[model samples]
Target: MSAENEVRQFIVAADDDGIRLDRWFKRHLEDVSFNIVSRWARTGQLRVDGARATPGDRLVQGQTIRVPPAEPVKPDTVKVKPDRPPLSDDQIAFMREMVIHQDASAIVLNKPPGLATQGGTKTHEHIDGLLDALQFDLEGRPKLVHRLDKDTSGALLIARTSRAAAFFSKSFSGRTAKKIYWALVMGVPEIEDGIIDLPLAKQPGTGGEKMHVDEKEGAPSRTRYRVIEAAGNKTAWVELQPFTGRTHQLRVHMAAIGHPIVGDGKYGLQEAFLTGGISRKMHLHARRIRIDHPDGGKLDATAELPSHFAESMKTLGFDLSLGDWIPLDDGPVPPTREQKKAMGRAHAKSVRKERRGERGRRRG
Candidate 1:
């Protein structure tokens, strides 16, 4: 065996106590790729406190992690890439202009439409790339805690530190964060206020880019929408609150009820367009976001509408003052696991009672 063939051991620190084993590797062993870590776990070479552990296993403080010897690098295995080009003055100015709110731990941007939150294939100019300019006074670049669609505009939050990122991520996952969205739908709903309680699954053949209502096999999704104003039954301005963070939940829920957001051709088809010079861009905007601050208190921010959206509202003659103050409801809350189990038992009991009643009626 080579000199480097000896195993290495690490003790989990308090800061990394609850982090996954793979994440610990990334933080400390930057040269150790994820694939190597997975292979070590699969071959029983990776362990925590003398027990075979997976990459996803959470580490506890003072736990010993046994790691196999570093794999030797092969010829042409490592690729050296150039560093990112420095941001131009214009780019830095634009990114700074997007900031609507900033605190020690968080920064909120009034992200405009057409700029993606993160880059994908063929997408080069994105908010993620511009985050470097927002890193003012911070050693690390701010991290995105949530996302908004490329066509949707409005309040997007960024965490200035890793601790803030973890805190904001937990707040969103716990559903304690409140997000209010505004959208102009194709038609006015008969009910001014209602909840869309449909289950959603990715539409087959769309490559998971589109969502549709699925009854038998789908994740539970719920959205509460209230019509703020209507223009002669042709269109309505609505406020949307999603209880579950499904992909495109607000867009899918609105479309499923036959009132797709204006200009959403993917889901609404030709009917998504309006003829009265309304902007062809998607009309959904995240109007406001409120969440618990990492330090204390609450961080609440409101983003102004994009120019196109503001113009459309002016054309519709809907007062801007009326838009932001709509009373929010308690909204749809997901059932807890214990509540679901109790409901299941109650449903089975009802079924048994009905069966017994059927037998009694036959005897009569």
Candidate 2:
């Protein structure tokens, strides 16, 4: 430990009362690794309420925890490097062109479809790797506060500073941030406007890439949707507002309700692709986001539909003018913290039940 570093004490917040000790460390002291936490616990260096604590030990509200000083990691010991090479001139220019809004606190990009927000296996090009191009002459590199799917095009927010990033992150995780999406589904829903309250879980055996509707073992997911226009029940332009963020929540929810977004092969199946000269790109777009800004006023931005989505709308005879209209009222109020906790508990119970069932099946 460096001379500047000292032992730190923390009081468990009400919101984190029942969370595991290791999870608490990950949330508050993100730089501390699980290995370090484990080592400390084994060596009696970590304590809660003046006693040794375990990684899985649940913390209580107002409990006192003593955290030891973290040793500064030497530069030579760092192993991981930037995943991809620096952006080329053309890549830089392309990124610059995507900027729809930029200010001291944030930058909003009209992210195009077919572009991944961050890189993964087999993914070379992504917004994260190309963000250097957006720097211009700014002092600090911009950071992504949220993410959209690879095929989802639209308003992607990038925080300009670390403070701004932390602020936006809190806003999002606290459910104060509001996002609206525009998607063209293959079939028109029977109801013009309604809410989908479906629980979502990773599909078994998918290696965590795909989501499925699993009421028994899934997290609470809700989406409010209104149909803007429909072409004789064949296809509809729908506006979606997700109340709870989940992996592929909108896509899986729509598909679970029997109206998958067009061109979504992973969730929707073959019928999702429209024939007859319509572009076979996913039609989901993150249309708008409204949130409290770090600098006092509201931060809001809207992204125009990608060219393919626009063409599809025109072909389906849906009016494009409706996209400009913002909802008169703040959409749905986010759930209370207690309600969120209850939902989380239900999901965890379901997961445990599922694991037991799987074990029984294996034994049989």
Report the Cα RMSD per candidate: 4.2, 10.6
Question: What is the Cα-based TM-score of model 2?
Answer: 0.74
Worst lDDT window (10 residues) for model 1? 329-338
List the lowest-lDDT window of 10 residues for candidate 2. Answer: 328-337
Extract clashing residue pairs from model 1.
none
Native-structure RMSD, model 1: 4.2
lDDT of candidate 2 over 233-265, digit per residue (tens): 678888999888999999999999999999998
lDDT of 1 at 305: 96
Provide TM-scores for the models: 0.83, 0.74
User: How many collisions per candidate?
Assistant: 0, 0
The list of candidate 1 runs beyond 4 A from truth reads 1-18, 38-54, 59-69, 79-82, 327-364
In model 2, state the lDDT of residue 177.
92
List ranges where model 2 is wrong by over 4 Å. 1-84, 326-364
* Deviation in Å, model 1, residue 111 alpha carbon: 0.6
